[model samples]
Target: MHASDTVDEQLELAADLPPWEKLASKARALKVMEEANKIIEDFPTWEYWVFFLLFMTEFFLAVYVSINLLK
Candidate 1:
């Protein structure tokens, strides 16, 4: 079938590709995670507090609306 020829070509192309190690190794993964943690830890404390307060406000607002609807 014509469809099978396309599939075979795709499979052959995939088989010919070289191994990519960018995110495939444990050491590379750990390095990426460390970099991410460093960025998050460097983020401003004030911003975290502001986000937390905003989230709590939204949560309580949702609860209030739900209770009012049930009344």
Candidate 2:
């Protein structure tokens, strides 16, 4: 093969390498973001307070009904 042909092949190989590296980096970053989002979603927050309030309300209602039944 000629010198120019070898240089062209080298350039093509270099060009291909960078795009693969960039795609891999992007995939890694996306995976990290997805994991972070899952962690955030799993965590209990103010929503837990709302659930606690509802549970308390139900417990009070049950107690009230039981007391009235006893009377």
Candidate 3:
């Protein structure tokens, strides 16, 4: 809530973390990306349906705005 409390918490956090380069290994990074790609490639049709609905909403919104501005 107060400034001093925020500063103290941040200092405590900074003291505990390792340097960025030492965090995750190159092999671990590759493994994570490979797993993510597999998940994306295997998506079901139902998920595509959701994406279609979201896109249709945006398309309709654009059409509505264009018509109103022309008026």
Candidate 4:
């Protein structure tokens, strides 16, 4: 009801945590990564590769033209 009461509740909750909470959180995160890998393996796409190749080609052409102009 008061500011001190709210602070006491928060402190109590924090103190009641199990010692292995951090380890358990990391395990849950690893499980999520494993699931993501499975999904990506099942449905791989290649539009990203096409865009990447186009970007690199344009970048190299620009660099080549600039170097030839300086020489």
Which one is best on TM-score?
2
* Winning model by lDDT: 2
Model 1 lDDT at residue 18: 49
Cα-based TM-score, every candidate: 0.39, 0.43, 0.38, 0.42
Q: lDDT, candidate 3, residue 45?
A: 76
Which parts of model 1 have CA positions greater than 4 angstroms off? 1-44
Clashes by residue pair, model 4: none
Q: What is the lDDT of residue 10 in candidate 2?
A: 43
Clashes of each: 0, 0, 0, 0
Weakest lDDT window of 10 consecutive positions for candidate 3? 1-10
Instruction: For each candidate in turn, give its C-alpha RMSD to the true structure in angstroms.
Output: 13.1, 14.6, 13.3, 12.8
Candidate 4 lDDT over residue span 1-71, tens digit each: 22223333444544556757544544555566667678878774698788889999999999999999999
Error of 3 at 70 (Å): 0.5
Candidate 1 lDDT, 1-71, residue by residue in tens: 12223433444444545455322343444555667778889988998899999999999999999999999
After superposition of all CA atoms, the RMSD between model 1 and the true structure is: 13.1
Runs of candidate 2 exceeding 4 Å displacement: 1-17, 49-71
Estimate, for each residue in 6-42, the C-alpha lDDT of model 3 and write its tens digit: 3334445555556653243333455566677788788
Question: What lDDT does candidate 4 reach at residue 55?
Answer: 100
Model 2 lDDT tens row, 1-71: 22223333444445556777655655555566667778889988998999999999999999999999999
Q: In what order do the candidates fall by TM-score, top score first?
A: 2, 4, 1, 3
